[model samples]
Every structure is written in C-alpha cells, then in structure tokens.
Target chain A: MELFTYENIIGIAAGICTSIAMLPQLIKVIKTKETADLSVTMIGVLIVGVSLWVYYGFLQNEVPIILSNSFSVVVNLTLLICWFLFRKKS
Target chain B: MELFTYENIIGIAAGICTSIAMLPQLIKVIKTKETADLSVTMIGVLIVGVSLWVYYGFLQNEVPIILSNSFSVVVNLTLLICWFLFRKKS
Candidate 1:
C-alpha cells in the first residue's frame, strides 16, 4: 500500500485540522471567560462522538485516527469544562 | 466485509453524532441571535476540515463518510452564516 498518497494526505490534513480546531475555541473561551453563545449540547455530543471515533480507531489499530481524535477529545473536554465554569458567570 | 459489525456500528454512531453535533449550536445562534462567545476561526477551520473529509471519503468511495461529512459541512456553514448575521447584532 502506498502511504502519502493524495487521499492519505487529505485525510491526514483533515485529521490535523479537526484535532486542533477546538484549541482556538478553548483559548478564546478561557481568554474571554465567556460561554454565553456556546452550546453545551454541541460540545457534549462532540465529546461522545469523538470518543467513539477513538474507540473505533483502536479496534482497527489505526494509530493516526486514534491519536488525532484523542487530541480532539482532550481539547473538547477542556472546552466543555471551561464552558461549565464560565456558563453561569457570563 | 461484514456489515453492521461492532466496529462498523461504532463508526456509524460516531459519524451520526458528529454530523449532528453542531445543530444545537446553530439553533441556539438562530434563536438567541448571539455569537459573541463563538470563535469564527474554529468554525472556519472545521468547515475546511470537514469538507476535506468529504472529499477524502469521495475519493475512497466511502458513502457513509461522504454523507455524514456533507451534512456536517452544511450545518457548519449555516452556523457560520448565522454567526455573521448575528455577531454584529449581539
């Protein structure tokens, strides 16, 4: 199997994008200490969804998927936690 | 390949969860007309990332991935549009 193919590159790029996408939001939430516009359901569902992806990756032994989605889960967890802390305050 | 295997079910569940995860946020934005706490960069990055995943799914002939990510892209786009519509009003 050829690694680094066009499709693989796109997949990896997508993974990287999603994996790090929430970090900025987390930072924004923390910096602003705001969560009024954020939706708790969205973040909660995403955590469950991404965790399932992580488990599926584990079943398939796909390291990239596991690692990237795991990263996403961590960022998402922090985002949710920050939302909880700041939700009532805002 | 066996259809509806445990791993396949997990994958599908994950897809469904992620595909619909942003809906609540969109609804909140529309109903509340607020976007102050939302991060434009996160939504933009997610749109790009999910769109890439759609393309990758197409290239790989994965119908489920393509469909789910397509739905997610639409939701994310609407969320972004809603943000634009309401950000200034907030």
Candidate 2:
C-alpha cells in the first residue's frame, strides 16, 4: 500500500477541520433565520478573499484549490441569499 | 500606471466578489442572533474546504492563496464561536 505524503494528509486534514467548523454557523443561520450577530464587513472581506483563492487556483491550475473554493463561494452565496430573505420578511 | 495581467485581475475580482457575498449573511447573523437556518453540515464542509485551500496554497508557495484563505479560516471560525454562544443561550 502506498502511503499518502505528509503534505497531502495535511491538506486533507485542514480541509476537514475548516469544513467542520463551518457547520454550526450554517446550521444556526438556516434554522433561526437570523444572521444579525455576524458582521457584514467580515463576511464581505471573506467573500472577496475566497474569490481571490479561486482565481489563484485557476492561475496555478490547481484542482483542489479550485474545487474547494468554488464550492465555498456557492455555499457563502446561499447564506447571503438567506440573509436577504430574512431581512425582507422582517 | 501598470495594468495588471488578466490572470491577476481575475484573481482579484473573484476574491472581491466572494468576500462581498459573505457580508450580508454575516451581518444578519450578528444582528438577529439567529443562525438556525444554516446547516451544520454545510458550514462544516466549507470550513474544511477552506482549510484545504490554505494547505494547497502553502504547498504551492502561493502568497495570495495563503493570505486569503488564512483570513477566511479566522472569520469562519469566529462565526462558529458565535453560533455556539447563540446555541447556549437558546
């Protein structure tokens, strides 16, 4: 059996950790229909930052970076949409 | 004035777009103290994905990727913390 390199493992591990970390907040937002505690500026900065990651991935032709960030962009966008709907209702 | 290459511009654009997208949701969450609408699985996945992006950036020796994702990890983690506090309250 060929062992995965340390770098690959680390990358995969980090991915898992970050992904898990996002779970609670996403869950809370969906269920409560409230995103008031979070800051707009921070989210905005993050969105731009992730977009840059996607571009960087494309430039480097890295599959993991592209796939990961693309998915993240979609998820974050969905959250934004939810926030809008919540606002419209309230 | 030196014009950035198309690739650089694209990278910057994506970063900005993604970062902007995160703003509303974060704001809503903070203001309302409601994150129930969000899914744990989804946020978890995102956190993991971003972590992997960071690792990928490091592996590639890319400055933009590393910096952007690092910041994202921090932000996402903060949201998670807020979610925990919110959950504990309700």
Candidate 3:
C-alpha cells in the first residue's frame, strides 16, 4: 500500500482549510465589531456539524479528522459567542 | 458490521448539516441586503475549502461527500457573489 496518495493529500488539505477557515472571520468580527451580516443559523448549524464530525472521527478512529474538527468546533463556538456580543453594534 | 452504526449516523448528519448550513445565511443576505459584516477572506477560504472537498470526494470516490460538498460549493459561491453585490448597501 502506498503512503500518502493524492486523495490523502487533498483530504488533509481540505480538512485543514475548514479547520482554520473561521479565524479570519473571527478576527474581522472582533476588529470591526460587525456581525449583522453573519447568519446565526449558519453558525449554529456549523457548530452542530463540526461537533458531529468530531464524534464521527472518534467512531471512525480517525485522528486527523478528530483533531481538525475539534479546532473547528472551538473556532465556531467562539465565533458564535462573538456574533451574539457584537451583533448589536451598528 | 451493522449498516447504521453511530458513527455513520453521526457522520451522515454532519455531512448533511454542513451541506445545507449556508442556506439561512443566503436567505438573510437576500432579505436584508446586508453584507458588510461578512468576511470576504472567510468566504474566499471557504470556497476554496469546499471546492477542495469536492475534489477530495472524487479522489476518494465517496458519492455522499461529493454530493454534499458540491451543494455547499454552490451555496458558498452564491454567497460570495451576494456579498459582493450587497456589501455596498448600508
């Protein structure tokens, strides 16, 4: 069996991309105090989704999926809280 | 092995949740015509992330992942275009 096929590479890259995808939004939200345009439903659903992914990783015994999605859950949670705090501004 | 293990159930739920997570945001954006609070960097990164997911699915030959992320890519792309369109308002 080959180690690190193209599928593995792309899957890993995709996971990493999603894991860190929210940082920019969190930073922008904190810096700009803007949250009105961000959808609460989207954030809520994402939290649920990432949280499920984390559990699924455990069930699938996939460490990479677990770690990446755990990070995403944290970021998503933080973003959600920030949205609540900042949405009232402007 | 059972067909519907907890992992599969959770994984499928996660995929479904992530797939449709953006609809509410799109609806909100269209109804309110607000996009200033949205992050272009976040959107850009997400578009890339989901697109890569689609490719990863193809590489893995996972029909569910491909279908779900394809829907997400469409929604994310639409949201990006909407962000561009409505950002100037208010």
Candidate 4:
C-alpha cells in the first residue's frame, strides 16, 4: 500500500487548510481579549465534530486525518480555553 | 463495495458534525449583528480549505467528503456574507 499518493496529498492539503482555519480567531481572542462575538456553540460543536473525524481517521487508518484533526482539536481547544478565560472580561 | 459500512458511517458522522459546526456562529452573527470578534481571516481560510476538500473528494470519489465539504462551503460562504453585511453595522 502506498502511504503517500496523489489522493492523500490532496487530503493533506485540505487538512492543512481546515486544521489551521481557526488560528486567526484564536489569536484575535487572545490578543484583543474579545470573544463575545464568537459563538461558544460553534466552537463546542467543532470540538465534537473534529473528535469524530479523529475517530474516523483511526477507523480508516488514515494518517492525515488523524494528524490534521488532532491539530485542529488542539486549536479549537485553545480557542475554547481562551473563550472561557476572556469572554467574561470582554 | 459497501456503500454503507461502519467506517463510512463514522466518516459521515464526522462530516455531519463538522459540516454544521459553523451554523451557530452564522446564526449568532445574523441575530446579533456582531462581527468584531469573529476573524474574517479564519472564515476566508475555511472557504479555501473546504474548497480543497471538495476537490479532494472529487479526486477520491468520496461522497461524504463531497457532500460535507459542499455543505461547509455554503455555510462558510454565508458566514462571510453575513460578516460583510453586519460587520459594518455593528
């Protein structure tokens, strides 16, 4: 079985994009100390959704899915933490 | 080929979760007319990333990937439009 193929590369690209999609928001929340406008439900749902992706990756033995979703989980978790800490103050 | 398998079901679940993750944010933006804390960069990147996923899906001929990404593209696009419409007013 080929580990790195054209199809997986495309998946990796998609993963990279979606994985880092929330970086700016997380940074903005941390730097500006503003989070009221951000939706808690959305972030929460993302955590659940990305976790499922991680599970799906595990089931499929897809490295990109696992790695990307793991990275996104971390990002989303950071955002959630920031939201909790700063939302009240903002 | 099994169209509905346990693995595919997991993927579909993941897809559904992620696909709808942005709904809350979009709704909040529309309802409150607030966009200050929401990062435009994040949304823009999501659009690009999800589009790649759509392409990846096409390459792989994965229905879940195609459908879920297509849904997310619509959702993210709507969010972007909402950001533009309400960001200024808020």
- Model 2, A34-80: lDDT tens digits are 87755555655666666676777667665555665676666667677
Those runs of model 2 whose alpha carbons end farther than 4 Å from true positions after fitting are A1-56, A68-90, B1-9
Every candidate's lDDT:
0.80, 0.64, 0.76, 0.81
How are the candidates ranked when ordered by DockQ, highest leading?
A: 4, 1, 3, 2
- By DockQ, the best candidate is 4
For model 3, the stretches where C-alpha displacement exceeds 4 angstroms are A1-3, A29-44, A80-90, B1-7, B87-90
When sorted by TM-score, best at the front, the candidate numbers are: 4, 1, 3, 2
Stretch of 10 with least lDDT, candidate 1 chain A? A59-68
| Model 1, residue A43: C-alpha shift (Å) | 3.5
Q: Largest lDDT belongs to which candidate?
A: 4
In the range B1-90, model 1's lDDT, one tens digit per residue, is: 465778778878988888677677677778889888677898899899999988877776655566778898888899899888887787
Q: What is the lDDT of residue B18 in candidate 4?
A: 81
- Work out the TM-score per prediction: 0.77, 0.55, 0.73, 0.81
What lDDT would candidate 1 get against the real structure?
A: 0.80
lDDT of 1 at B70: 88
Per-residue accuracy of model 3 over B1-90 as CA lDDT, tens digit each = 353666667777898987677677778878888887577887888888888978876765555456777888888888888888877785
Q: Write the per-residue lDDT of candidate 4 for residues B9-70, one digit (tens) a residue.
A: 87788898887876776777778888876678888888998999888778866676778889
**Can you tell me the CAPRI class of model 3?**
medium
| Chain A vs native chain A, TM-score per candidate | 0.81, 0.76, 0.79, 0.88
Better of 1 and 2 by DockQ: 1
- Kept native contacts, fraction for each prediction: 0.86, 0.66, 0.84, 0.91
